[model samples]
Target chain A: MTYCVGLLVNAGMVLLSDTRTNAGLDNIATYRKMFVFEDPGERVITILTAGSLSVTQTTIARLKDAVRGPDVDAETSIMLAPTLLRVAEIIGNTLAAVRADVDEKLVAMGQGVSASMIVAGQRRGGEMRMFLIYPEGNFIEATEDTPFLQIGEHKYGKPILDRVVTPATSLADAQKAVLLSMDSTLRSNLSVGMPLDLAVIERDACRVTLRRRIEAGDPGFRAMSDAWSKALRDGFAQITL
Target chain B: MTYCVGLLVNAGMVLLSDTRTNAGLDNIATYRKMFVFEDPGERVITILTAGSLSVTQTTIARLKDAVRGPDVDAETSIMLAPTLLRVAEIIGNTLAAVRADVDEKLVAMGQGVSASMIVAGQRRGGEMRMFLIYPEGNFIEATEDTPFLQIGEHKYGKPILDRVVTPATSLADAQKAVLLSMDSTLRSNLSVGMPLDLAVIERDACRVTLRRRIEAGDPGFRAMSDAWSKALRDGFAQITL
Candidate 1:
């Protein structure tokens, strides 16, 4: 299991994901789920995945293969695509195909594959966009009315996002919102653990601006988590019955 | 589609439940899920139900018939049960029976019956107790380390309860905690709606000491919800990115 969230605000885009993957309680492992593809001043694409590792990894590998192929074209390569929407379509179709192939082989053994992803970035001359692509290859774009998209262990972290996020939020504030959202999910769910992968892409920059890894026992994250717990207790004490 | 939570603390017990039930998006109705049975000075039992309305309604009806029957005895009637555990057992058995009966009939239409419940109260000579009863007549009791039990769409409201609730929490504080928990669930889920039933049982009283119904336009609830939202936004603004 994993927890990943992506937000598109007026200033830019923020994406965060946990690195824990488990086949069972005793088989837990850490695996990075964020992948980035960028061409300095031309285009930037970030993908955050959650679900069956085999499917997501294979799909991403195939996507990279397409981008590096000798005959790379607009229809087959995400970097060569005309718009972010087309990039999402190519990724979605690839993800669906990979999942179907994996599921077919695993079905005979009473096993299956399941995966979904968040696509966020900008391309020169094109507007910034964010989408949640499903395992079935269809996707929904985040709009001004709903400026965020999340997948996996989402409910525990949703209330805070629902109350605090909006399209006009600043880039810095958007990062804080997603971090807190991930914090809530990490505390409530055992399957989702740290260290976290975080990235920020400034609007229209067509490149990644900030990328950081919050390792276990990182002071900044610890301080924020403690501060949040204290604030919640204080607020709880202040509320009248 | 419902949200019901029950908490047991040193001071007593707090139970809150919403009254919304839905057959589909187009078919929604208001139905009370909390039922109270009290012999005042001798014993008290509160049942909070969630799932198939047919199963729960039939189970409650049968339990009432048993209590009112001429041959009612300790083994057959909740009011005459010696301990809260026995009362929970009686309720659990009844629920499982009712579910099986309902499922047998609904199976012809390719439908099924599913229901679960939280039983909380105390008997005059026994200790306070709370149990979450499953559809198969099995149940798990709440302990001091984890003093809360929830059923139906529970994740959205769980983080707060996990942070604030404890066995030593005061009755007043417990009530506030459960109400806020319910408020979170109501905001995040469409199936859990307005018109809530709240009840508190004092530690050795063996009966409900406080009970109230919060209607849709209730001022107190509205004010509390608004205050909580404001506190969250203010807290978010104060945090550093």
Candidate 2:
């Protein structure tokens, strides 16, 4: 299990993902689930993955290969795609293909492999956009009405996002909202663990503006989590029935 | 679908439940999911249910019939049971039997019906207790370490309960916590809807101390929900990350 969220606000896009992966309770391991492809001021693409590790890893590997291979073209390479929508389409199609291949191998065991991803990026002279790519290769883009997309272990952390996030939220505030949302999920679900990957892409910059890896016992994250908990408790104490 | 929660605190027990039931999105109806069997000061047992309607309704009907039957006994009637633990056992067995019967009928459709329940009650001179009964008739009691139990569409409402609930929490505060929790669920899930039933049982009293049904437009509930949203936003704004 994993928890990855991408928020698109007026200022920029904020993306965060946990690193824990488990075959079972006893087989837990840390694996980075956030991938970035960027060409400085020209274009930037970030992908956050969740679900069967084999399918996600293979899909990402193929996408990277398409970007590096000699036969790279706009149709095959997400990095070469002319627009954010085309990039999403390429990633979705690649993810769907990889999932189907993996599911075939697992069919005899009455099992299937699938994965979903959050795609956020912008190309020079193109609009910034965010999308949630489904395992079936279809996707939904974030709009002004609901400018956040989340995949995997999403419910425990959703209320805070629902209450606090909007299209007009500033970049700094958006970062705070996603981290606090992840904090709630971490407390309630053991499957979603640290360290975490967080990236911010300023609107129209076509590059990742700020990126950080938050680890367990990281002082700043710990302080924020503890402070948020205290504030919630205080707020709860003051509410009358 | 339904959302039901039971919180056991030093001051008392608080139970809240939504009344929405649906076979499909277009076939929605209102059905009470909370049942109470009380002998006043002698004993009081409240059951909050979730999952397949047929199984839960039939199980509750049979329990009521046993209590009203001519040959009522400790082994057959929950009201006559010697301890709260025994009452839970009786309910668990009845639920398991009813589920098995229902599952057999649905087997041809390759579907199996199941239900879960939260049982909270106390008997005169006995300890207060709450049990989460699984479809298989097994149950785990709420303890000091974790004094709340939730069933059905539970994740959206869990973070607040995890942060604020404790054995030392006051009954008034407990009610607020559960209602706020339900408020979060209502905002996130269309399946869990309006007209909620709330009940409070004070410690050692063995009877419901306060009971109310909050309709969609109830002024008091509306005010509390609005205030909570405001407090949370204010709290989020004040936090520096």
Cα RMSDs, all models: 1.3, 1.0
Error of 2 at A102 (Å): 1.0
Could you tell me the TM-score of candidate 1? 0.97
Model 1 residue pairs with clashes: none
lDDT of 2 by residue, A105-192 (tens): 9999999887999999999998999999999999999999999999999999999999999999999999999999999999999999
DockQ of 2: 0.84
Q: Write the per-residue lDDT of candidate 1 for residues B1-241, one digit (tens) a residue.
A: 9999999999999999999999997899999999999989788999999999999899999999889999999897999887778888999999999999989998899989899999998888799999999999899999999999999989889988988999989999999898899888888789999999999999999899999999998998888888888877877787776
Docking class of 1: medium
Q: In angstroms, how far off is B109's CA in candidate 2?
A: 1.4
After superposition, the stretches of candidate 1 with alpha carbons farther than 4 Å from their true spots are none
Residue pair clashes in candidate 2: none
- Writing each residue's lDDT as its tens digit, candidate 1 over A58-79 gives 9999999999999899998999
Candidate 2: lDDT of A117? 100
lDDT of 2: 0.95
